[model samples]
Target chain A: MITEQHILSAFDRDLESVQAMIMKMGGLVEAALSDAAAALETQDEALAEQVRKGDAAIDALEESVNAECARLIALRGPIAGDLRTVLTVMKIATALERSGDYAKNLAKRALVLGQLAPIPGAAGAIRRLARQVGLLLKDALDAFIARDAGLAEDVRQRDLEVDQMYNALFREFLTFMMEDPRNITACMHLHFIAKNIERVGDHATTIAEQVIYLTTGTLPGGDRPKADLTVEGQ
Target chain B: MITEQHILSAFDRDLESVQAMIMKMGGLVEAALSDAAAALETQDEALAEQVRKGDAAIDALEESVNAECARLIALRGPIAGDLRTVLTVMKIATALERSGDYAKNLAKRALVLGQLAPIPGAAGAIRRLARQVGLLLKDALDAFIARDAGLAEDVRQRDLEVDQMYNALFREFLTFMMEDPRNITACMHLHFIAKNIERVGDHATTIAEQVIYLTTGTLPGGDRPKADLTVEGQ
Candidate 1:
């Protein structure tokens, strides 16, 4: 007895709810990235633990987003643009969930680094790097909400700076290790932590691409520029 | 008007082609992992280049699989079990493509490591770890093809072995770097290579989880056992 219009309205409601969930997940990841960076700078073990614990919520939200997306696809049978929108939302959720994992990892390394003697300038450099990636993620999410491909492309371009920052941090960690053998373990942890944060930047860039694709129905041609060829992360 | 049976058969054909692509992608990844290990052991720059170049094909396959899955979801509007099957194939393809990326990363590191003097036994240890993960991927793909959740669960359990192997390699690299300051750069590259390979195992296990979910309609309760908590990958 249901009319086509009723079903169409139902689809719209489902899509709206799912999109809201994506934004919510993005907000949580942004907070986690920034908070984890602050915790590292301050050597706040309690804050780090909280970041680690909060990852579960992000994971749960991702699962819900994915499930809701799948349900929308199967039930509504959206074609063309609506299908692309659902697919984009699912992809964004996956990327955000991974960024959350990396933030949690940075927090884990921060806790370990807290017990060691402060490496000159390491924590501050790491915090700066984290802030850059956090802002990149925030912009990407805003672009998604605004449906602004230009903003998304701008966010994509910004990742080159993040890569340069990560490379500099990598060399500094290497120098610290070479300067003092005692610095080896701490520096190694720091190196991985920086790598993890760089990965968060990579995720942010990927989210931007998703936004571009959703808006334009095509992925940007050619590779996004990379300052370093070092391959790490998904 | 087209018969419902005709639509069903068309869906089957599309799915069959997509699943074949998944297997092909999986095969390429498995070979890439093994070859990358051999290239590292023999310091064969040519083989490493081959692995890197081969990744483009895997990326193409992933794109094709994703597009085909999206098309099926839209045109065929597969519901319930059929929808789940298509979703599973898409997820497995994603895992395989990431596994391919890690293999390519291993090759990149091999090229770097070839420039430096070998760390004692590092090549053999890494090759062994790569082989373990390779075997794990083989089983995961087999599970996908055979619809064998039991096999998938077995693969899941075996990741613990991969984790333990990687942990041992991490410590060995640390010891090597500490023993000789000159060894630091080479060991850092090796540590990341081993970590990348370990991530290949993680992706393989993720493929296994997707297979399990398809067969049983549930993700395994709780976290998969992780040997070490040093977070390093997506």
Candidate 2:
């Protein structure tokens, strides 16, 4: 009943649909990250509450993406490029979902820290790290959409910068905690939220790697040198 | 030119080959983990060096497993179960590769610490955590090998325990560094290495999740109660 043209067109259609859904998910996550950062800035318990409620939608989206990928792979036997695209989407869904979790983590901590006096811009490192990671996520997804391996490679390089920022931020927190031991728990929570952001960056880098592999049939670690950085979270 | 029987048998052969290779990779990673622990206990830089050297072979093996999966997926056009098997193998290969990376990270740090002074049983926590994660790794692969979702679920539950141990170990290290600033650098390395081991445990949980998904067609996180742990990781 099914013809070859039908299958190819159907594959293309499904790929397009998946890409759109992923971008939508990316948009939601980006907004979540920004909102979480703003929540910390304003110590907005209400916005923090919203982030916790929003996580369920992100989780549902991830599940739906996986289900769609599975259904497509079953109904249509896609070839290398199509297969890679589906797999990449599936992997990115997990990463994006976790990024949402990171945002929620930050929001949760922000709520707790709301009870205390402000540390006078204690959230600066987290904001910078979140923004950097958000850009990486955007660029990685854009590269995938554009099928641009060069853009993907560039995103991979940016991961090192995030890693460096993560360590420096961690060191700064360590110094803060050392200066005031009472800040240990609060700073630790912030450190983990920052770590979650770095991990999101890593996952974006992973998507970039998959894009390069899909396009060129080679992984990027061979001759491509990773940027030198503080080397934490590896 | 390809017969149905040929395709089926080729799929079977390749799947079996991939399983074998995954188990082999798992074994190598376990050895590296154990050797790294031993190096820590005995201040054996030679053993740590050996683990570092052994990682290249694990890397090579992982590459082969990946290539084999790609080849099978391309050539055979495998069906539902066969396809999941190949995909799972690819996923497991990645988890195993990261396990090796963790072992290598531990060994690298052991090399550095061994040069500083005798570690003086600093390897205790690493040894315990490595063994726990190693067991989880083995059980996860076994579940994959036998297609046993039940065993995989058990591994998933056990991951919580490993995480708790890592957290406790981390807190202890944090306290050690807090008590004496001189321990900061060494403790930092130890903390990250422990974090990597804990992550390896989580990756094993992921493999288990894939197993459950492959068999039951349901992802485990929704509506399921969180695993009860005496010492929670987060």
Who wins the TM-score comparison?
1
DockQ of 2: 0.26
Q: What is the TM-score of chain B alone in each candidate?
A: 0.94, 0.90
User: How big is the RMSD of model 2?
Assistant: 3.6
Calculate each model's fnat, 2 decimals.
Answer: 0.43, 0.10
Q: Residue by residue across B1-234, what tens digits does model 2's lDDT show?
A: 478788778778878888899999999998898888888777797898899888989988988997787677767877677776777787778778877977987888777776453323457878888899889988998898887999999998898788678767767776766676556556656766787788788778888888898888677966333332211233
* Backbone collisions counted per model: 0, 0
At residue B125, give the lDDT of candidate 2. 75
Task: Mark the 10 consecutive residues where model 2 chain B has the least summed lDDT.
Answer: B224-233
Q: What lDDT would each prediction earn against the true structure? A: 0.87, 0.78
Candidate 2: regions farther than 4 A off:
A1-3, A108-120, A221-234, B1-6, B49-56, B112-122, B221-234
| Model 2: per-residue Cα lDDT at residue A118 | 57
* Residue-wise C-alpha lDDT for candidate 1, range A121-176, written one tens digit per residue: 98899889988999999999899888899999999899999998988888888888
DockQ of candidates 1 onward, in order?
A: 0.45, 0.26
Error of 2 at A99 (Å): 3.7
